[model samples]
Target: MIKLTEINKIYRTNEIETVALENVNLEVEKGEFLSIMGPSGCGKSTLLNIIGLLDAPTSGIIEIGGTRTDGMKDKQLAAFRNKKLGFVFQSFHLINSLNVLDNVELPLLYRKVSAKERRHLAEEVLAKVGLSHRMRHMPTQLSGGQCQRVAIARAIIGNPEIILADEPTGNLDSKMGAEVMELLHQLNKEDGRTIVMVTHNEEQAKQTSRTVRFFDGRQVE
Candidate 1:
């Protein structure tokens, strides 16, 4: 469902250049749960950002669900990203001022969805994530695991084809992390949502269907 060819990403300054990804080639089939494992500074998160359309590669081609995204304009990319991709970050990036339901509804609001429809869809997604009862709770009132579940609810509210999770379990305890991973696994297996997760935990990586390791900005066997 996703393909990357000879992808290269570089950060530059007037005097120095650093490569974050080098000639990276990858393919993630539909409904596959894949883990990217790497030590610090190995470009795993960079790769995830590129795949999620949050950032562009310095050079390469990226195709997602049969659409080529390499040359899409900013507006087009933003629209495509909203329609095709979802993201979960290491930190539960929820708006503290918004309750669980409103946070989950934020994406739909940006799409110009009407209030009634947005509330309906947001509640459905919250129910799917088992957070229906926590809808009125603020982020600070939830446990780490519950907060992460709320984040997942936000991610999937749009019904995107792919979900990109960067260190999704990084902030949780082992049990909580496992719970989050299980949720992601269920999404992949039962709902057919393609997931590409970046993780440093070997055991967590093993829980996925496939694992890709990275070293020094390149995929390693």
Candidate 2:
């Protein structure tokens, strides 16, 4: 479903350049749950961002769902991202003022869908995450777990084929983290969603279908 060949990401300043990823090649099959593990500043999140199309690679080929995304303009990339990718962040980037349902419905607002249908889709995904009861509550009113659940709902509401989770369980307590992990598993296994997650927890990484370790911006075999 996703393939990267000879991908490299470099960040440059006036005098120094840092390598965030080096000659990285990876392929994730459809419905596979792949975990990326690395120490801080080792390019785990950078790799995820590149694969998610949030950032473009310096020079490489990125094929997602059989389409090459390398040379697309910004507008085309945005449309492709909306239709093919969903993102879950470590910070659970939800709007503080919007209710759970409204936040989940935000992704659909850009589409040619009606308000009523958006509401229905939002509620459906929230229900999938077992958060239908909190639909009207604001982000401030919810716990960390609830916030992430809301984030997950917002992500999958568009029914994107790939889910990119960057340190998804980083902020929650153990139990809540477990809950979110289980929810992700259900999405991958039952719903046939392709999941690529970056995580520090060894046990959580173990639970995934495969785990790839990184060091100093290179994949370590």
Highest lDDT: which candidate? 2
Tell me how many clashing residue pairs each candidate has. 0, 0
Pairs in steric clash, model 1: none
The TM-score of predicted model 2 comes to: 0.97
Residues 130-165 of candidate 1: C-alpha lDDT, one tens digit per residue: 888999999999999999999999999999989999
Best by TM-score: 2
**Model 1 TM-score relative to the real fold:** 0.96
- lDDT score at residue 170, model 2, on the 0-100 scale: 99
Off by over 4 Å in 1: 210-216
Off by over 4 Å in 2: 210-216
lDDT (Cα, tens digit) per residue for candidate 2, span 93-153: 9999889999999999999999999999998999999998999999999999999999999
lDDT of each: 0.89, 0.90
Candidate 1, position 126, lDDT: 87
